[model samples]
Structure formats: C-alpha cells, structure tokens
Target: MAAFRSVLNVANSAKLALSSRTMASHPLAGLLGRLNHVAIATPDLEKSANFYKSLGAKVSEAVPQKEHGVYTVFVELPNSKIELLHPFGEKSPIQAFLNKNKDGGMHHICIEVRCIDEAVKAVRDKKIRTLGEKPKIGAHGKPVMFLHPKDCGGVLIELEQE
Candidate 1:
C-alpha cells in the first residue's frame, strides 16, 4: 500500500509539473495592443500620397529612411494610419515586392505592443520566427520587429513598441 501511494504521488507531481510548464509558455494577455498602421508598397510615392490626400485624408510628406531603404508617408485616419512605402535605394527591401506587385498593394501590418522584448519572447516561445534577431528602429522611431510571414498565416506582421 505504501509503495502504491508513492507511485500515485509521483504521477500526480509529474502532471502538475507539466501543467505548470504549459501555463508558463502560454501567451500573456494584452501582449499586443492596437493596430498601428497598414503598410502598402507603392512604385510612385507622390501619386499614392496624392490619392490619399484626394480622399480628404491628412497625408504626411515623404520621409526618407535610408537605413531601412524605403521612403515612407503616413496617411492619418481616426482609428489608425496607412504607411505608404517606396523604394529609396538600389537595395531597397521593398523593391522586389514592388516588382511583383507593380500597381502597389498591402505589404504588412504593424501592431503595437506594450513591451517589445516581452512580445518577441512570447512569439518565439510559440515557435514563431522573427525576421531579425533583434528589434530595429522603425519608421515611427520605435523599436520594431517583423515576424516571419510563413508562420503568420501568409501575412507579414510587424510588432512596434508603443
């Protein structure tokens, strides 16, 4: 009877350990915040900016982000914003995207996070791959990281620190 009780106790302890590990790996609530912006890859920056302006949206002037190899313009909306991306340099990251999508289209979506480091860890724990090992300064001058599109239902996801 004593030996049987010891075995039962060991099984119960193992089950509790497994459950604790599962809980620890689960994503924390409120890790992700509001949608920051939706990025669009455009061949003609001015035309795209004009289109938004024509729609009575407040559009920002093109700002060159040489480090990121793209020029960006923000179209302000009540809820969120639209980021228009144009290739800046020869090795612009969005060049291939523009080539494939000549008319311009939705590129990526940026979502705000309270803590970027914590968000990255949470995604990585769930086997999601980040585009870069560390977060980089994004167009909004905030720390941002892009998650692998393949893991995110065929859509590129950008997590920006808010």
Candidate 2:
C-alpha cells in the first residue's frame, strides 16, 4: 500500500539521520570489531549464579540495580561477562521480558565497544532495528541501547559503554 510505503520511507529516513548524528559523537568508533558481554534473564538470581559458578565462572557479588528494579550478578570471564538479572520490582524490565518470554533464558547480547554511539551507527547502517531512540543510562551509570532481534538475524544485541 502507498501509505505503508510512505511510513517505511519516513522510518528509514529517521534511521539515517540518527546514524549520522551518532557518528559525530561516537566514542567507541574504534572498537566495533569485537563483542563485550552477554545478559541472561532469570527469575531467581541465586540459582543462576550457582549454576554459572558450577561452570567455573568467577561471579561478582550480587549488585542491587535499584534504578532498573532488578538485582544483578555478574560472571567475569576472560573476555566477556555473563550478567544475571533477577527482577526486584513489578516495574522491572526483566519482569516485563519474562512475562513476554514465559521462561528464564538469554535476554540480550552486549558488545563492549570503546564508543557506543559509533557502534549504534554501524548497526543502523546495516539496517538493524534499534529499540531505544537514544542511549539510556543503565545500571552502574553505563549508557546502553538495544537493537531489535528481528533486524539482527534473530539475536537481541545491546550496545554499551562506560
């Protein structure tokens, strides 16, 4: 339909505009060639941490993520982290995700780039659909944005930086 096509054009144009602006402010532009971390969503944080510990990961202490309404535990590997999220409040993003997925599982894959804004632009140029209109302040004061799985070959990708 002509209307649908018009809507698509507008959305595409917006993506281009955003990508250009992001590139201008990119800090991680030098590091888009590697991955950073992976996030898993679980209803029970302790159980998840125990499971990863069995796999020989040195997990960090459970960190309270009050802003995101979740308790977070981190498994530090040589290259990446496996972050386990336990929902703490009804408004938690984990709670919303679990309600939709109906099970504990992989939530999002995060790539730690030197410049998050540049990575965002790269993904957008590849025609990936991003979730956040702009990078939001995440736990531990990190800036993060998520890319829609449908545009990422069925994988939810998160872009993050300090």
Candidate 3:
C-alpha cells in the first residue's frame, strides 16, 4: 500500500509539472486586458442615443468616421462603454449588418490588450484570422484590429491597444 501511494504521488506530480509548462508556453496568457466596449449597430443614431439617455446613461454626440464609413456615439457606463454605430457612407461596413438587423442589435465586442502588435502575432500563430493585415486607428483613437467572426465562435471581436 505504501509503494502504491508513492507511485500515485509521482504520477500526480508529473501531471502538475506538465500542466505548468503548457500554461507557461501559451503566448496569449496575460496578453488580453479589460473589456473596452460593446458595439451596437443602429439604424437611427439619434433614437439609439435617446434610448440610452432615457435609461440615465450619459451619451456622447455622433462622431463621423469617414475612414471607417460609420458614425459613432458613445454611451458612457460606470465600468465600460456602449458604442453606437450607424452607416456613414454608401459602402459602410455596418450597412450590411444593419440590413440584416433592421431594428439595431449588438454588433461586436471590443477587448483591450497590453500590446497590439504582440497580440496580433500571437493570434496569427494560433491560426486566428484577422480582418486586416495591420491594426487601424479605431474610434477611441487607439490601434485596433478585428478578428474573423467565424474563428471566434461567430462573434466579431475587436482587440484594442491599451
């Protein structure tokens, strides 16, 4: 019985050592940071802003992002933010989304990362596809990149630099 217990202990120790090594080898561990904001695609920016304001949330004015082909409004929250997006131009990216979700709906989630470059590389190494080759200046004036929705459980994910 003593010998059997000793063997079990050794096996457990080996398993623990392997687990530690695997975790340490993960490149994305501790790379991701806080939730930045949740984006919602809206057909009417003013109405959406009013909806949030009615809920006592402080909302910002609509800011046009010609480069991104969308207008953004930020609804301030205690912990994070709610981003309201509407089509700005004829080829707006959110236009298609709005077509599908006519009444407006949750668009994408933005997460902050410690380093955008490193995060991009790690995600690529792990076989995750990015929407663009490099990070672009996002609505918050920070470097941001979008990951392919299919690779991320059918939900678009935006990684912003902190």
Candidate 4:
C-alpha cells in the first residue's frame, strides 16, 4: 500500500510538471516579443539584397561572419528586417540548407525577447532544444539563441535580446 501511494504521488507530480508549462497559451509566451527578422538562405547574397533594394527596401552591406561561416545582410522594413544569408567558409552551417534549397529560401525567423536567459529556460523546461550554445552574439550584436526546428513546427526559431 505504501509503495502504491508513492507511485501515485510521483505520477501526479509528473503530470503537474508537464501541465504547468503546457497549459493554454504556454508559460513561455510572455517571454517572446516582436518579430525581429525573417532569415533567407541565398546562394547569392548580393543578388538577393539587390532584389529587395529594387523593391525600395533598404538593404545593408554584406557582413561576413567567419566564426559562423556565413555572410549576412539585413533588408530593413518598417516593422522588421529580412536577413539574407550566404555561405562564407567551408563549414558553413547553411551549406546543407543551400544544397537542399538550390535557389535558397526562407530559413528562419528571429523574435525579440526581453531576457535571453529566461527565454532559454522556458523553452528548455518544455523539452525543446536550443541549437547551439545558450546564447551567442548575433548580427545585431545582441545575445541570441536558436531553437531546434523539430520542436518549433519545422521552422528554425531564433530568440534575440530585445
């Protein structure tokens, strides 16, 4: 009887733990802010940026990220920006994405968060994995983290400091 009671208590505890975070709207919703940017993987960053420019979009200069092995550019919009990404080094993470996409397309979307640490914790508590390290400095020079696509409905989601 004691063992049965112990097992029941453990089951209830597990149920509460999962429910506390998975309930309506999610416990992490409050941590997410506005859409910062939508990233597009491109075989040719310059060409893509120019295309947006032709549409009257303000495009920034291509910035090569050696550590990340990708070149990046931001096309500024009224509410957000479009990030153009291209492979720079031999081991660029986007290489596989480009190989599969050929012409390249939307890769991910970045969202603003007031506290990166809190955001990470919230996602992790829900059993979602962060792509790389907890937080790395992104193009905007703000601490950022990425969530694995499998847990995020097939779209890579990036969280950045607001």
How many clashes in each candidate?
A: 0, 3, 0, 0
| Candidate with the larger lDDT of 1 and 2 | 1
Over 4 Å off in model 1, which ranges? 1-28
Higher lDDT: candidate 1 or 3? Answer: 3
lDDT by residue for model 2 (83-150), tens: 88878777888898888776688988877666678777877886777887778777647888888999
Per-residue alpha-carbon lDDT of model 1 for 22-82, expressed as tens digits? 8776575568799999999999999999999999999999999999999999999999999
Judged by lDDT against the true structure, how good is candidate 1? 0.94
Clashing pairs in 1: none
Residue-level lDDT of model 4, residues 1-162, one tens digit each, is: 999999999999999988866754566767889999999999988789889999999899999988778899999999999999999888998998999999999999999999999999889989999997669998899999999999999999999999
Q: Superposing every Cα of model 1 onto the true structure, what RMSD results? A: 9.5
Models 1 onward score TM values of: 0.83, 0.69, 0.84, 0.83
* Candidate 4: residue 114 lDDT (0-100): 99
Tens digits of per-residue lDDT for model 3, 7-79 = 9999999999999889778766688899999999999999999999999999999999999999999999999
**Residue pairs in clash, model 2:** 27-115, 28-114, 28-115
Off by over 4 Å in 4: 1-24
User: Which 10 successive residues of model 3 have the least lDDT summed?
Assistant: 23-32
- The C-alpha local distance difference test score for the whole of candidate 2 amounts to 0.80
